[model samples]
Target: MTCSEPARTTTGRLPGGLVTTTRRIRRTLAAGPRVVIAAVVKALGYRLVRVQYHGTLGEADGAVPRGTTVFDDEVPAVANLDPALLGALREAAKDAANDGVEFFVNSGWRSPEYQNRLRREAVSRYGSEKEAARWVATPGTSPHVSGNAVDIGPSEAKAWLSEHGARYGLCQIYRNEPWHYELRPEAVEHGCPPMYPDPSHDPRMRQ
Candidate 1:
């Protein structure tokens, strides 16, 4: 449907009764063969690397710095989160804890310097700097840069979250990275793609 067309529910209701859906059929046409090729590659498991908080990379490591406090720590910077989203997450965590699954925020809000250092380290180890880009996003492009994203719980909690996180406005963005979740509704609606780097030719790449 065209963007100007008013959305309607199947039951012929308007307002909150209807869900707004956006289609990118025309945008895909303009995106050309590359988008299709990328989709195919993604389907074939030529997927991006999953980064996690406190994950080790070689001896020096790269992910989030060790010993950095989680978002739920004392005097939390909960202001970094959207209020509604934060409340939802807190309720979700409490619910999980009630179910005997402990949930905790592991990381949030990365500085540009930290992201840059990670990008540089990944480049050094992987050889192809472009390859590094696939895993460690450039500073401005990172969701962590926005301070609205968080890595939650631990490795063991992955399965539990996969089964139940959606009830609380959280979803694992990367299939392989269980800890990461974002407050963006678009992420939930679109089915969270792994936080891969923007394509090399993407205009944002130059930044």
Candidate 2:
């Protein structure tokens, strides 16, 4: 439905949908038609946020931040993180290593092609698009493809980071993803923001 569609809308609700749009997000979405409607709402909104590629994924050559660098003999390979975010992650990882926990970079700086592949793989594994979207993000708006996110791994590393990451301005953005961390500089001063309950409700997914 277009924004002008008439079915009556309260603040935050989609113009013609019954699934209430919300600011407080959950990390996992239940599989159902209402959730499917929420996915469509987010999908449409994402298209509008892409000022450059017009919602095309994996073609963001212009999205690369200036001065971005690749890994240099690090304990684990992680490339294409935002320059400042990489610095913060290294510092945080160094500290975590002191506690006998090393953060392994499972993914970093994914291309649109790569991200889309992940989405496809997820859809196959989960058996449906709506269920897959609750986990893997569509490429165009994924922070990872834009070099803004890194997934850390190893249960021990995730455990250590969960407890101490905020001190270094690192934060886990999703409630269900314990190993995903992003550089949230404000966390150093105010601490990490609360995790989104799930991607379906996360306002960021729409952007």
Candidate 3:
């Protein structure tokens, strides 16, 4: 179909193979600058859009890091975090190592099924949905399911991350869990937003 054809449809698929290009732009804008640039290229009528078309734009330019063993599981665990996040962690770990600190991953990139199981376990461990929500998130809503959250460990590492992680867009989002971190690249420019007090206070965890 021509650009003159109705661009709006329930599917949001534009004629030149721009499936959901409009929503893609919004998500791109929300995700970060690199993805936004990818969307901009598409918005400017470029049909050659590639790589950046994934919902999160594939680490600014398809630069996913090779998985490596670390602590509990490994890099790119069962679900695999965003490559950019993995990259940042690698660099941070190197710097941390130089300071005589060792970083370790307690959990990373859990499958949705795994997340739900954890939630159920949390309910069992914590005694109620309310208490469980204070720690674990529901399946679809958890950043771990989306490969966007990680739980790091070893007190020294958490301490170093607390002091230096914002430099790499990794931040402890929940005040209650210092080991839990997420990539918010904007943190590099805008300063790590603000903590949510706990998962109970995080709006995303309300599911």
List candidate 3 stretches off by more than 4 Å.
1-79
In order of TM-score, best first, we have: 3, 2, 1
Error of 1 at 86 (Å): 2.7
TM per candidate comes to 0.53, 0.63, 0.63
Tens-digit lDDT string for candidate 2 (1-207):
234243333445465333333322232255654555556556444322222223454323223332232344332224456888888888877777688767666667777777888889999999998888788899887888777887777788788888898988889989888878888989999999999966656787877
- CA lDDT, every model vs. true structure: 0.56, 0.69, 0.73
The residue pairs in collision within model 2 are 25-197, 26-197, 26-198, 27-197, 27-198, 58-112
* Candidate order (lDDT): 3, 2, 1
Candidate 1 per-residue C-alpha lDDT over 94-168 given as tens digits, one digit per residue, 9 for 90 to 100: 667777776555656566666677779889988977777655668887666566667776655556767766666
Show model 2 residue runs off by greater than 4 Å.
1-77
Candidate 2 overall lDDT versus native: 0.69
After superposing candidate 1, which stretches have Cα over 4 Å from the reference? 1-79, 186-207
Across 30-97, the per-residue lDDT of candidate 3 in tens digits comes to 78876677566656555442342333322221222343223323234622777787788888988999
